[model samples]
Target: MLEIVAVPAFADNYLWLIHDPVSGETVAVDPGDSVPLLAEAERRGWPIGQVWNTHWHPDHSGGNEAVKQAGATVYAPASEAARIPGVDVALKEGDRVRIGEHQAEVWEVPGHTLGHIAYVLRDDGIAFVGDTLFAMGCGRLFEGTPQQMFESLQRIAALPADTRLYCAHEYTLSNARFAAAAEPANDAIAHRLKAVEQARQAGEMTVPTTVAEELQTNVFVRAHDPQDFARLRTSKDTFR
Candidate 1:
């Protein structure tokens, strides 16, 4: 079976460790820091051999060099390889990354960064989204336009409802608040907000949010058009 464990880094980033017990191989995704990630790997006895990057953000690929130093190969986006410190493989859309017997489809999800990408383990119904789509929010428009972000979100929304979304940050509580603000009348958002608050109070992880939950509550994904999406993105940016 494919087991994904979340390794908290910095203040809020979630560095994922994908392990395949059958082959005893491990894959690290968007490791923002080396200290915690390497430590967790050692504690769990999962020797990481591959590192998959989603973008060139410092908070995402900052640990690439260190992970490489630990004998792991790095796989990054083809378009943004120059920005990443150490990229062993430059991948594009339709490419596949394998961990043991499991394979994940690579997609170019540009918006947070011009070369931002995401990985979907189709058979396992899991997706590792970088900074593109958050729990209830979306990534900021750093290099790409709102149109690109909107389209990218649509692509993700096309996934099966059962797909578990593993985004890079632990922003569910804040996002739930924003979701409720965006759609005041949404009972789903209200319900999620209450649940997220409780989870945060108890010091729990609010990730692995299913696609069904996002569809029912994510205002950004429910946006009807680019104009609508753009307006909402602007609102979220200035909100707070």
Candidate 2:
């Protein structure tokens, strides 16, 4: 089995540490800062052998150079290689990466950035989505268009309902508020809002949300079409 750990950094960012016990291989995903990531890995006695980047954003690939210096091979999106630091392998859609015996397929999920990608481990039923798909929201359209984001989200929604998404940030509380406003009549959104509120108030993480849960509550994921998604994205940008 793959063992995953979430390492919090810079207030909201979550850097994932994935370990495959069988192969004793460890990988760091979207490590914005090398300090916390290195500390966490050392504490767990797991030497990171690979660093997988989702995009060229500073807060996602800033630690690439440092991690690579520590002897980890760096893999980043092919389209954004020039912008990202220390990219040894440029991955595109359908490319595969492995940790121990588990393999993850690369998926182009641009929205937050034009070259953003996701790592999906089908056998494990989990996906490290970077900033593309959040718990109840999606990434801001920094370099991609609403149409592209909508298509990316639809691809994610098509995954089995049980698929667990590990997004980069903890934006669930604020996203729930927007979701409630977007679908005031949705009992699911309302109920999820209440739950999210409690979780945040109690200082708990509300991520690793399942596809089924997002389908029922995420306004963007529930959008009727690309136009609808565009409106929701615009609203979220100005919300609160």
Candidate 3:
């Protein structure tokens, strides 16, 4: 079986470390910084085998050089080949990547970035959806349009309800607060907000939220149509 661990990087950023105990190999996802990831891998005595990037944001690709120097194969979206540093394998949707005995399917999810991609580990039932779908919200439309983002979220939400969501950032508490403001009467949102607050107060990371939880509490995903989704996106953009 594969084991997944979250390595807290800079404030709010999470670099997921997935390992295969039988093979003693580990792969890191969205390693925003190299020093911390390298140190953590060394601390755990696991050799870094692969580096996966969901997008070309600085915070997501900053550790490319370090990971590459350590002899890890870096995989990024084909559309962002020039943007991502040290991308050895450029993948698109329908592609598959092997991590020891486990494997992940490449899902081309743009909107946060033109070529943002999510890796859905079929065996482990976890989706490493960086910045695309958050706990109670989705990513800002920095590069793609709202329609693109909405479709992306739809694709992600269609995954198995049990699929664990491993997002790049720790925006659960803030997103849940905004969700509560948008849908004050939503029982799931209210319950999640209180639970998230407690988790934060205890210095814990409130992540790995299931697809089912997001569907129930995430306002952006629950929007009826593109128009409503766009309005919500605009409101979130202007929200303080």
Compare the candidates by lDDT and give the number of the best one. 2
Q: How high is the lDDT of residue 12 in model 2? A: 98
lDDT of 3 at 4: 85
lDDT by residue for model 3 over 183-209, one digit each (tens)? 999998999999999999999888988
Q: Model 1: clashing residue pairs?
A: none
Candidate 1, residue 170: CA error in Å? Answer: 0.9
Give me the runs in candidate 2 sitting further than 4 Å from their true place.
none
Which ten-residue region of model 2 has the weakest summed lDDT? 62-71
TM-score (C-alpha, index-matched) for candidate 1: 0.99
Off by over 4 Å in 1: none
Residue pairs of candidate 2 with colliding backbone atoms: none
> For each candidate, what TM-score against the reference?
0.99, 0.99, 0.98
lDDT (10s digit) by residue, model 1, range 108-200: 999999999999999999999999998987899999988999999999989999999999999888888888999999999999999999999
Per-residue lDDT tens digits for candidate 2, residues 27-130, read 99998999999999999999999999999999999998998898899999999999999999999999999987788999999888999999999999999999
**Model 2 / residue 188 / CA error / Å:** 0.9
lDDT measured at residue 32 in model 1 versus the true structure, 0 to 100: 85
- Where is model 3 more than 4 Å wrong at Cα? none
